[model samples]
Target: MNRTTRLQQITVTLLSAGLLTLSGWGAAASPVQAAAASVAAPACGTGDHGLLQDLQKAHSGADSIPLSFSDVEFLNTNIGRAAGNGFLIGTSDGGCHFQKIYEGQWSFQQIDFPDNVHGWALAAVKDGQAKYLLRTADGGSTWTRLSNQAVTFERVEFLDSSQGFGYNRASTYYTKDGGESWSLIKTPANTRGAAFTSRSNGWAVVIVPGSGYRVMKTTDGGAAWKQVLKSSTSDPIYGQISANDSQVYALLYGDSGMSQTSYSLYGSSNSGGSWTRVIAQETAGGGPAPGSGAAVAKKGPASGTPGNMVLIGKTTAFLAGYQPAAEEVGVGLTKNNGRTWSNQKAVPGFEGVISFTDHNRGWLAARDLNSSTLYVTKDAGATWTARFSFETAGR
Candidate 1:
């Protein structure tokens, strides 16, 4: 009676009849948290995107930031890690790497917090002529450029250190003290995602002169901005805007069936007055590999489950959309919310590329088409355990 006990007895009788237990499989192993790797509760039971902390919202219901597993941490990336709901905040670089995820190993502590690791930004040079602005608080590693005074930056936001905001092509700039100096409040404004959850109010999901997708608010941080949800419909493109006022989460996408290409998502309990879709339209099998328009992983495994999308932290709401880069496919979790799941398995020799923290814990690295078996799971996603070894032929 194996195959994980006949898929847990057909998923406890189809989750007692409420239906949809393992749909097309979210991950697999089954029971006893799949028997080890540290899962106290989710074995398809569940996992990664970090922060699951034994998850308990059982079907997306009431999760507006109560996450504080010691304020959560994990960061040991040397190859860019963040495509969905990716904003670890607090900056990194000059010494500021705290990405802690246990069980499979991925703990980058590197601390020296001294705020504003040389803040800078002034954009617009993708050929629109000239104009640049990009300063990293350590996360982007290294980048500096203080001026060009908003030529075509599209968008840049900061609400700490001194204060910040930048939007080129349409125009808007305001620095309070940290960016050295800057001023200007308007020009064209066609932004798609901006955040400053604090320092006044801050929020942006722009494109307001007749385009669509608008929800611009500012208490003082950006100095002034107030359009609050105004999208008549210009094809949908509301990138992201994490929240704090009770709860808010927004990451939108559009233009996906051809080269004009564009997609990146999430939509929270929503904010202001309208807009409520909540992660959908994830068409995997490959999307970001033709000129680098950037957008893939919308339900990998050949477009199933409506092309799934998963994001677990930075204002956890379980929003999802596109995530199939096909290293054979990976993403599984079940801390009891979706009832049962396990065995969408792959880690025999390893080729999954997973990562996690705050719920049982998880991590897996090595992405060179194969030959990277590093594993660890603490049961929130139920089970796994492999430990050491590395090489994409080297490293």
Candidate 2:
């Protein structure tokens, strides 16, 4: 059997063995239809700074702050997908700090990492250019600068501490001995995003410059690749690609008009050869509501287009977003792969990113004028409780 097929079999076996549980918020309750009232901010004492506050403080007097706290990446270990075990690379004026959260509490220790380091993949600056790959085996406490390469990497993915892949502006690269060395993987230009199920099976989304996007799959690591799906003029495709062991999901977006922004969710069971449109909706841009004075646009899905998504299984997934029409943040649940969707209760505040540990438990990062907080949901997004609140630091 091929590596992809074997990996799928192993995943099925693990799930059957109860090694993995597929539970998340709203796994049992009905779909929510209305927005949940905004809750009061939790009382936090001194020394309870949030990730954003730290970033703001770090670049307080700088001419420009290129990084936003909302854009900071949080790495969730696969062993405990969302049970409060995660890592965040904190940045501030001083330097970088590795923050680890265990059981809902955060412990931080500063490290000698560079600023603007995003996600688990690290990069080093040489003469104002990011030129080398770096890895940290001991969480984010320390990093070993890998041998320098002639590529300016923009994104990197590590399946484990040692093995991983990275891509520059127009090329793909891989490394097996951590980031110490890397070899180029020939692929089409304009490749933007990639995900690998194993060393030999993976997929990437390549944009055709002024045209649209296409999905590419690799079976022998990144050494070889083939185009599996291409966007046509009739149905233009544009969005990011995310995958698991057996399936790949794409959150596509299209601009119809100021009053007709389109969003769609597509899934592929056989890599990227074909896709099924699981959910489709059109966002009514800022305009008169239906039956008002102007032309009434199509109503958006009950659940707004989520900026992020977390797939629990082949058929189960959760999407959450802050709806401008309703002026609230809400979540939607789909058990049959987007054929049908149920809107969960909306919560007040802008939901930045959503992560789930299982099918029944997850966490959300929310931001408001006064503070940024992390909310935890135990009932699969049916309800939420504020777990941590960080006061926005003053300018």
Candidate 3:
């Protein structure tokens, strides 16, 4: 009775039963791209096995095989979904074209899509120490492997299709039935990231072995949590957490020494109860630290912040970073939720992962280490365009 009032009574019962509309793509065509090109092939048979096989090969001529996507989700602007390395691609029309809805050898890292046809992934299993949890209703074609026990959760958040929340650094998992079953809550000792707006409301970013970061919260859900926010000392702070309904964001960074590295972004429109730093620390550099003999600090302007953030509504938010000496990519926008911040228009690559499905569509995944590229923006990040690319060892 408080998931935003049951999602505003399920969007007023889907606009009084008309099923709530508003979808476009020029000429008459696009029922979610004709139901995603009518199931873009997802039935790989080889005695299938766990992790939902399918997608044996063919990502484009020449055996396309170099992917490094860690995450990407666009339930709009022409269906979209992406996962890392081992594959789990999809696209109807928006990002040029993408296929292969599932594959394995292990590697999903993170993915969550609370709605638009349920989704959730976290796999890792490739001798990577095990971790699994994959699910997809109809949007990503096919995927099913709820849990075989090893749960590490690099990060995942959902608030629909039956609640969700998972974090890393050892534990923190919860599912309210949509994940088939999962529950190991009671987090706090180093939980790397977490974000939730309902299912009782939540937030996390702990890491205090010697005292460095904290930003816990919960409201009758994760059993119990408190520590509003911390980290004014202890030097090793690093953080992450993002939310939209009831707002809630946290970034945090550390190491502000001669080599720089001080970021901070905090906001909370109630879900977290109280918080407001927006963006403060703002520093960035990584050119000297191999020896501790720092020197070569003559860059005088263009500091940095926005390590990465996404919250396309609830006042709007979008932040990205990667300005290694202005090579490109450095946006840091905010509509009002963060008081003020503006400097859009600077896309290129290497922002890793970012997503937005509102305030004018968005997507970015510029991984590196061989290949991984995909960018798009309608006018929100000011500008950007580069649909797809994933090549390695075939180049």
Candidate 4:
């Protein structure tokens, strides 16, 4: 049998058994429909402090801060917005060129839209100085600063115009009046990430201190939570979760044994009720090859960091992470619901955020320490064309 067939067979067998152990070989806004299949499914991820530092450096020596996009959202084949490092830019003719919509000192770390007409942005000043929330109603063509509160959240997601969640590593807050004000929501301590399908359903990534990480679910908004998935003390879970309606995705990491660290992908079709091992234990040294059931890992890959995952629908998802096999950042695509995955184009970065409007077209914002590059793919994830590097956008 071919490697893909064999790996699919192994996945089915392991999934039927319950949890796929660390052995060998490794959101919200439902109310708003996607604008087009040729665009992305809104924005659904965040950057880390390292990214913020990169933004700070890029902001310091230039007359205009470059388009170091922390997050990107494409509403259609020809309309999109990219935000980061004191600026928000939009394009009316695909991504060929962009015009600035908003610029300031606070870097925009995340942006979310319930629909093409309603959106939100989360920003924080360099050096941990302050935080601000902004809103846009004309498809990001213009933005209005909503509030300049003491909000420490690094990410934001809106289920609709007036309901959304803003969370960080410490706590989560909910806003019902279009970012006007927020109320502290009691979540598990150290809630690192959160995503919601509606005003009433949500999931969170919580750190378990002495143990590991947890994937928790809540039916009544964020008032209560139940443990749906947990990691072992040795193989801790990463702090990023993405959910849309009843489908969810979470990450678990293997022990970083000095040389390399591995990761596994878990998927749930019924919210966070149960999970199946989509990708099995994949080590840095001796793991199976890409289409042979294991996702690749880099040597000494950052501990507690998992690859970025963006779900396109119920059956299609994209995985972006380090691919030591090729010594470049790689993209993996699964059309048969992770029964199999094909490693797609390799981009020039160690980390990336993927956005897909559907199975055919997508965009990737790939970043290294010195620059962030944008790429567009027309044939799903098979091939990519460099559109522009954010490091040189305004130069």
Q: Which ten residues in a row have the lowest lDDT in candidate 3?
A: 5-14
Residues 1-395, candidate 2: write the lDDT tens digits: 00111010001011222221212111221223111112222332223234445544544564522222232222221111111111343211111112222111121111111112211443334123344454544334444455555346655666544566665445667777766677877665667666666678877777665566677888887777898766532334345566776567765555544424465556666566666666556444522211112211132233454565666666667666665444466666666655566666766564455666456666666565555556667787889776555554353
Report lDDT per candidate. 0.36, 0.48, 0.60, 0.60
Using lDDT as the measure, name the better of candidate 1 and candidate 4.
Answer: 4
Candidate 1 has its poorest 10 consecutive residues by lDDT at 1-10
TM-score of 2: 0.59
Model 1: per-residue Cα lDDT over 239-293, one tens digit each: 5565545344444445455212243333333344343333233333223311112
Residue 201 lDDT, candidate 1, scale 0-100: 64
Give the Å shift of residue 216 in candidate 3.
18
Please say which candidate is ahead in TM-score: 1 or 4: 4
lDDT of 3 by residue, 208-314 (tens): 65556788888877788898877554554557777766678777665554434565567776666776666554343432111112122212112443455777656
Compute the lDDT of residue 289 as modeled in candidate 4: 15
Off by over 4 Å in 4: 1-67, 103-106, 125-129, 207-211, 235-238, 253-261, 280-307, 323-327, 368-371, 390-395
lDDT score, candidate 3, position 74: 70
Query: What lDDT score is found at residue 103 in candidate 4?
Result: 60
Whichever of 1 and 2 has more lDDT, that candidate is 2
